[model samples]
Target: MTSPLSEPADDVIRAALKAHGGLDRWRNVAYVSADVAFDGVAWNTKTREHPLSHARVTVETGEQRTVLTPFLGADRRSSYSPGLAAVVLADGRVERARSQPRAAFVNDTGETAWDELKLAYFTGFAFWNYLNLPFLVARPGFAVEEVAPVKTSTGTWQRVSYSFPREIATHNRVQAMYFDEEGILQRLDYNSEIFGGQPTAHMLSGYETVDGIQFPTRREIVPRDQDGTPAAGPVLIGMTFTDIEVVNARA
Candidate 1:
């Protein structure tokens, strides 16, 4: 089938796919599992202060289910699915839950029960989208166009602006990705509507090959200004994934 991405953008995407492992290799995978350590300023919005307890996440790719353990507080698991979100405490009790997206989450008046779980929903889906990158852009309902090159201290980067279909769950419907000469994704730019439409810069580094796929072990997301330059201050979110596992659906 013909790709939606422009010819130049398609070339870059193909190089990225080959660098990561190959579209066919990623397409065959049914699920991927990894233990992740989550921390950053983004979490502060939920707690109203810096967090002390650790957060561990497990994502199911095909099913689109994200399970967050030790979220907000210890021994708590927040499971976010398509239509519903649930939080289970240590004692096996469903502490706080919600059935669907709410209107209140759109406006940032203050945090509420619905807001908390909605954040979980956003995180779950955002991570899933971030983990699956160049290949995901090739999927149906996604459009990609090459943008002007970005010159940095290190080198000039090839850029591409892409958008997700409304049906696809992501932090934002449209975002831009920057790749280095070798086709490794170096940065991602987007305005996260979930976070008040704040411009964000997500950096990918510490690449590790897991099961023949190149995965970024370290990720840092920070606020960016209107000019797409990094904003001053600490990062919004910093995470690292370890203990990676991938299983093919066909297998």
Candidate 2:
């Protein structure tokens, strides 16, 4: 095993980690809990919106785990990990479970409405990967490539394309993430395989520091064209995180 510093994309990754907070501070964190309100064209297109209107979400920092409370009802919660997704009682008894949840989305185009279990799987993997960017690139099993710098009104942004290993369930492999010269994340581009390979771009902003970590408070998504430029029309998914707290990692 080689040190991450020796990797090709180390410079950019390290810059991002340092600008957000050192890896040391991130390692001590167990999870991030926040109250988020989700809305946008994505949800509005669904048969019904996810029960996530003003819900609380907790995402594990070191692993691919997430829990969303008040999921469909006030007492039920959705639990997710790389291998499984389930809706469970407050006591954690599984009311439903889907092992190998990613497989369930095989050939799935998220354009159509989804059932309860499908929604659980989608919510789980989506946030689990979304909240763990830039830093997660340094973790094992991800192949990172520093791409060409892009210039925009915001500033000159550095882009890195990340390929996820099989062990992780994510929106798509080879997602390109953009960071400002200051190393803060600004946008992301990828084709959501589950959504039938529709190209999409995530425009991120509204940063707030918690426990010495810089976290994004707002995420806006839009369609992307073949050239990697974001669409100017309707926003796909608009997510805002509030009252975010970084919990200490367990001993």
Considering every candidate listed, which one attains the maximal TM-score? 2
Model number with the top lDDT: 2
lDDT of 2 by residue, 1-251 (tens): 22232223568888888899878777777788999888887776653644456678898877778898888888899998878889999887899998987787676566667667777888888887877776777677788888899999978999988898887788777799899989999999988877787899999999999989999999998999778788895888899999998888678
Off by over 4 Å in 1: 1-9, 49-53, 70-76, 88-96, 102-104, 109-116
| lDDT score of residue 239 within candidate 2 | 90
RMSD of 1: 3.9
What's the number of clashes in each of the models?
A: 0, 0
Residue ranges of candidate 2 with Cα displaced over 4 Å: 1-9, 47-51
Candidate 1 residue-wise lDDT, 1-251, digit = tens: 22332222477777878888887777677667677777776666554543423566666545557777777777787777656677789888888887765343666643422355776676677766877676678666778888899998889899988999776677778899999888889999998776777888998899888889988888889889878887765788788888877767665
198 in model 2: Cα distance from truth in Å?
0.7
